[model samples]
Target: MKVLYKKILDLEIWHDYYLGQPNPPKPPPTGYDISDMLALVPTPECLRVLRNLRWLFRPQPRGASIFAHVEQASSGDFATLLPVNRPEQLTFWLIVRDRYFANFTNLPLTTNRHQIYYFSNLSLNQGHALFLTQPLPNYAANSEYHLGQLVHHDGKTLEALLYQASASKNPNANDWDILPNSQYVSELDRLPQQGLSRIYTIPKANPGDIWRLTLVNVHEQETFVLDVTTPITHTPGDAIACSLNFSGQIPGCYKLCLNNIQVDRFVLCDPIASKDAFALVEIVLNQSLVPSAFSLLQPQDGNTLIKPKTYVIRCKNRATRWRYRYEKPHGFSAASLPNFELIDAKTYATKRPLGLRLQPDSLLTDGKDQLLPAPAIALIKPETDTQAHVTTIFSDIHL
Candidate 1:
């Protein structure tokens, strides 16, 4: 099976908002065969992000070379016995597009029927088997308890919470000002509650091991050992996972210790600050529609040469354009720090610093050459308005 598509799907899940609130579900996921999937191989940088995801385990029987996806599982599947392996994990591909958005009645899972240990070679793989679209049709009505769709922990929400939690330890940690042209800024503006959730591709977690999730916050010290159920097989290639639940917790940064080893952490931002919306600025290097490293200047004036202070976006693609912008801001105005100019072409400038919370009088797209001209097959498809959908960094700088 093509692994890259899986990575893209995982990343999409990590970045998406949880059912706590649902955005308009896009049309049914566009399915693709091997060729189409391979063509979308993101640059090495994206591969790096995919690499960062924690791999769960899936155990298969000794002769079972083939395994399949399982749709809505039954309650008694819990007692089904399977072989065991260490440091193994598994993730069920449950893609549900239902009318409820995330209103799955069976979303609140208990330790007994967690998803990690839910799959097996004996599991049916009906293509639709693993898909969880639209709350197990009103027809199957898989009992009242397991009825609703599942909900994974929202990574961005965790970041905000963790950021808030960190403030208790470091006052500088609550830096919630999203730089101009950041994804969250635009998401919030376009979709009020979007981007508040993070799309986290966690590090590899040991399969079959009872990992622990520790949340240390101002509210109360909390801890829980994760329950994993990997199939019994010495040699198998699959892992399982489920939605993490951090409900009933206060909003703040918290120390997240897993397996008592502090595998990762979570942050909860103040709800009010998170609700503020701004135009979303999708940026990429103009050179080849590839990713490039750049810096977002700090709000406070300072001599950075003494102490290098920079927010970096390291390039990880060979796409020609070193930087690219999917959407423009309200406008470009460096009045806060007048040494800047609106960029219009491909730029190789190393140091064009932007101030924090910079707002433009009007969007920069009004300028004739504000955007790089995209050819028919250009990476960027100009919006219907013919405005460049992506703004490439061609030239212009300010200090």
Candidate 2:
């Protein structure tokens, strides 16, 4: 049968038979250091139970390890080996780094169901010190336990156990895992706050003109400084109007500022035309800047009338706005309105009639009734004081 022994003081289990023996009759000057041998033995079932209880009470996942298996002794009567001859030590020296456990003066010690045969007094201190042994079990190394079992303990609460485990475990674990909880606690500190600035773009004069410059504040908490490679030239007292055209698309609105001073607000209504959608009513000054050219269509106002019997029809420009217009008069007899020709100043300057037409209606009007005339054609100039006139004549009939 496998025999297990627990320490009477801490209820911690031990695999070494010598740990079960009662304390020697003679007392030593300093407390006994059994942490060294405890390192050789795997965690006792009682110790694992105590660790679980401590974890439950503290509600912390800091110190916890899963046991894969426990080692069992092969020799006869492993617990009768006495206080010194056992293969593993019983006492463990726990070192408290800070005042972590200062409040818990009288800590109740309990272990697994294993029977404890011997124990030493408990001592808590700031520096290195030894505590009494608590023998709980006796197990042979590499006997029944597998190699993957893990054990955990707070460095502050049990520094010696951590060190011993590190030394005994093949290829020691990381220092972080071996250190006490106090050593792992970090100081409460914060990071500095930061601020950012907005981004802006420089305006260009022409639609295709390229401006590679960009203004921004890279620093998280610094003011933005705008420096343009292409210096904007403005008239002595006139403010500059800056607008953005997105790749020949419609223009967008943006605030215009001169030397960090608010001057005027402008918006791009038509990207192709680049007309100012919104501008101050009062024109402070004529910037003398030529606006971009655009194509526009305006409708003519009045109708043209053709005199019956006469092949020629006269028409005039009646529209306030001038635009290119093409007129095609239909519903006419072939004979009444004869085919005519169109002429411009550049083409027929000497001729009395600037425009000609043909294909009048063949249908004749009654002598008493007023008849509709053929279509007249003419080109009118926009914004000009002169009016547009057209003259047409029938080929067969002379007027």
Candidate 3:
């Protein structure tokens, strides 16, 4: 199978949400897939975020690894015995589509009958499978109760009275308790709640904050700048989106930056091959994208360095230009420090005089040729000093 598109469906029962509140929260949306009687269950909410996901697992029988084929028999019943290498940890895949399945009724599961486990080779060479355990029995209007018996009621899993025997039409809060199994469902972690809109979002910014996005061509040193200001008022969950209008731009590797921080680098391919060809990029904005944090590459830390040595520092994002300052003891200072520039995508190097140490406090400029408000990041500082060798002239009398 191509496995062209796949999403994780968390096998959840109703009791997962807090029922104490006046308004109980609905269960989260789930993804689905279907073929013949074999179908993955899908909720109305999941339709918004259906996107392709890729996962790599070691060749081992995992709890959610086995794919069960639910075949509908001619007797108007769904019956199929699946041989699982690890039945105790087995999970089943249920598929339903928006157009094929309606209202989630006539589900093929027969919970009253004991689910049989068989043994054989049933490896799936098709697409991936999402496993859901055989659901428990639905709650009855009135039923004899026992301790630890599990039942499904109103989309939740509840257990019987822990230490008492009773008959209750409506399950009492004390008589029944939500079980941990109710919370066992896989979440679509990588899928964004807002769906995949080809745009960039910067998080945690106040209203009316000015953000600048610069796209610099690496080879030509050409720059394209776009500035955006956050609206004074917007919806509660709305994010500040950075514009990516690459009009009048050429095809090359472009280093991207949001404000003074280097957010990403991408290549704009030549569109001559196909008019519909385009690139989609996503980036999360937070402290994680801060460009100030970098590592000292050359002159390993705590090592003594000789004079006129070149020091290199590497950052998470490529720096177009760099700033450096050298400090010496006894008030001695270099007349001019080397103007460190991008030696590579993420590295910056400069030759400095011996007997001086680089300060840990450093900053990266927002633009290549322009000075803007840049954030301060830690720089290289080898605690050790450069050993200065002084030569004495003993032949001064000949002069």
Give the number of the best model, judged by TM-score: 1
Write one digit per residue (lDDT tens) for candidate 3, span 1-399: 322212111222221111211123332234311123222222222221121112211111111121223333354432222211111111122222233221111121122121221110111111111112223456786665443355678767565533233457777885665533332121110111111112678875677778887765433244677788777885444677664666555333356777767776544432342122211111111112211121101121222111111111000111111223223221212322234432333333332111111122333232243332331222212121233211110100000
Pairwise lDDT winner, candidates 2 and 3 = 3
Candidate 3 — what's its lDDT? 0.30
Q: Report the number of clashing residue pairs per model.
A: 84, 40, 11
Model 1: number of clashes? Answer: 84
Relative to the true structure, how large is the alpha-carbon lDDT of every model?
A: 0.23, 0.21, 0.30
How many clashing residue pairs, candidate 2?
A: 40
- Decreasing lDDT order of the candidates: 3, 1, 2
Report the Cα lDDT for residue 105, model 2: 15
As a whole number from 0 to 100, the lDDT of residue 48 in candidate 3 is 18
Task: Give a tens-digit lDDT track for model 1, residues 1-399.
Answer: 532111101112211211111133221133311121111113223233223432122212110011212111143221101111111112122222233221112122122211111111111111212211111121112222111112112111111111121122221222221111111111101212211233322344444544445555322345333444443541234444444555443333345565555544433332343322111111111112211222111111211111111111100011111223334342433332132343443222212211111122222222233533221111221112233222221212221
Q: How accurate locally is residue 232 in candidate 1, as Cα lDDT from 0 to 100?
A: 55
